[model samples]
Target: MSKAFSAIDEDREVDRDAFTPGVEPQPTWCPGCGDFGVLKALKGAMAELGKDPEEILLATGIGCSGKLNSYFDSYGFHTIHGRSLPVARAAKLANHDLEVVAAGGDGDGYGIGGNHFMHTARENHDITYIVFNNEVFGLTKGQTSPTSPKGHKSKTQPHGSAKSPIRPLSLSMTSGASYVARTAAVNPNQAKDILVEAIQHDGFAHVDFLTQCPTWNKDAKQYVPYVDVQESDEYDFDVTDRREAQELMTETEEALYDGTVLTGRYYQDEQRPSYQAEKQSRGDMPEEPVAKRYFDDDYEWERSFDVIDRHK
Candidate 1:
């Protein structure tokens, strides 16, 4: 039996009057949280992409950044800690038409959800993963996170963080993500542009924003100052060339310590096939063998055959 269904193509049209004042609820971050800029960038990117807020799906994990979903007017999932990717992936698989975005703080993504991050990139799912790299876990009260620099003292790492900070851009490039980019929360224009590019990209697009958590990460200002914004010359790296992307990652690391901030799309591939391609590529849904064998009029025979097949 075939079932009739109707889908609302709400995303195709934009409502100029759709957004009301304070549509996006104010996030519950500290007074001067860098996540505010990240949120603004995302909203700006969505507007730039002409995506209807009703047609968007934002999934977030538990953290300061996770609270972001509550502020957006789109369909959102405030998932358990370190599980934003699965929620976002499931949403996309269920409805490939919607623009699915997963977001969380560095601790939520890189520390607990690091495995999921790897697999998600490898699968090359057509979704955008935004990481707010604040270096410290602000929600859990000023603990050192995975991206926290070595020798950075925090509540959890008072004597200084033991391990080195994880290079998210390099990790993303190595994970087979079709698109990878990095920007700072302070640079909203560049951040919005990168986010827009990531959202429009075919496969898994990872955008890591170095955000500042004033309440927790006091030293974050050294890299991302509130008043002083560092600008770097844009280097055009062949996104399709993996070697070139890797070299760019190395150069970016050097630039970071040398006090030059890197921004813009570091990697991308327009030719990569999206996740929806597999299901859509099938010639057509197959007919049941039982239907072709006249099983509709012979349920007893079909049931016997099913039992026999199962035993075999």
Candidate 2:
């Protein structure tokens, strides 16, 4: 999918509209799709952070979320299924200055992409990962996803799902993500704020965004009147407390199926050094961006490519 692409100038003052493509293509996601909320919140977060479109790299996998790069005006890669994290990690490694983000659906991220998600978090990579958790494979015509509720009925499992849903927040916390959050599409303000914090975070930040699929999974409960863990007087837990966060996340994950949707930032670790920073501190990573070296030696690399071709 490599092709010549142009970038927006860096010196221009960052505006919300700067992220919109010059020739904007209308999103094909179904009307009332929760994806629209994500797009809006993301644009708002980027604008708030004063991030130029050229300074960010958005990597997406094969799912409805993959179309994000097409609509958002940024340096992007539409990677293969379950591969967005690897691509995002590579981009971050090559240029620490680039803001890297990976987005995918629950099926794409928690199923086949589960391994990458685990290791990336374990390594504390410097990137923001957004998993659109709508409870089904929206792009594959509403199949049961890894996060689908137990006993949920789908075409793939007309008898209902026999397996329990994987606890995303618990998994993320246990897997070593430095920053963890859960936000819903129904709450755009909170979503934007969480995204802003996630992007600014230096270590791996995993946001399990609860999106609604109106066309599919009609049996799901309406996601409204959610309680923000941060704003609610009923729930009190320190955001920096891992054990407390784990307990709260368990309840939050369970409540989703019990007709209560809880949304908010649950955990954050500020002292942990990111994978890049740790490597650079040990003199393992280059002082300057590796991309600069690649560009400067482009002609020599091309000659080497020709030499390999002759051997073949």
Candidate 3:
């Protein structure tokens, strides 16, 4: 662990209220907004894990979901549109002891930041990525987002969108995310449980969170009566089996558009080493946090100008 985070490792019983800022800013979200559920569940999950706010980092992208950093009392970075993952990845690589989480809306994550989403999962970065999948772009006046259902009408697509929605769970699994799951804001219990597991996971954990946009997506199903795959006997499949997970994910994705919301852990591969672990195993990364080395006064450090002059 890095010297920077050595103090954070001290064990202490954490309270959920500890995450709330001293000056609580009332959320600006519209009435019945699902973002409130996310905040509550996240706080609950962190409290359950007994993680200190100083030990966690929250990186968010542009959109209503980006406001997560404002509400979450943690080390936070509000990055540009669709860039939360890259920033979170850098932080994790610099200080491996920090628990990193990246969050954004569907438009920001699956649309503008789709490449980052794919590559980050492909590289198996050790971070929890939460995509608030509300179908429409809630912050931008309800435009048809990447996860918008086929033929879904919006301000941008008054005649209804012609494109099919992206299957985030299947895509994450295919791209090598070691842990993948879907949860809804309406199901606070499930959401909290999933978040706790995701945070504790040692590999890339992708959570496709179904957030209802009551103001914009009034037509959206409230994600009620969500069937938990792990709890339901009707849907039995090995979470460790890639083929089984893929098949279930396909069915779940298709069912979402049809009004059935299936939510739970679809895949988990605990044996796969995370990117940071792989680098350390290969002796490419130092055991200490990279951030610590930069402040070493006694160590010789090369300046950028000196390197440029040498090259010249």
Best prediction by TM-score: 3
| Cα lDDT tens digits for candidate 1, 1-312 | 211011224335443333223554655788878888887888888777767766788999998888887776677899998999999987776666678899988999998999999989987888999999888888989988887777889877889888888888888878878898888887888888889888888889999887878877777673553221224335555767889888887787556645566666777888877655644566322222222333245444535555443543
What's the lDDT for all of these models?
A: 0.76, 0.89, 0.91
Model 1 ranges off by over 4 Å: 1-26, 222-236, 279-312
Point out the higher-scoring one by TM-score: 1 or 2.
2
Error of 2 at 10 (Å): 7.7
Pairs that collide, model 3 = none
TM-scores for all candidates: the values are 0.82, 0.91, 0.94
Q: Candidate 1 vs candidate 3: which has greater TM-score?
A: 3
Residues 122-155, candidate 3: write the lDDT tens digits: 9999999999999999998899999999999988
TM-score of predicted structure 3: 0.94
**For residue 266, what is the lDDT in candidate 1?**
76
TM-score of 2: 0.91
Q: What is the C-alpha RMSD of each candidate to the true structure, in Å?
A: 6.4, 4.8, 2.8
lDDT of 2 by residue, 155-184 (tens): 999999999999999999899999999998
Using lDDT as the yardstick, the better of models 1 and 3 is: 3
Higher-TM-score candidate of 2 and 3: 3
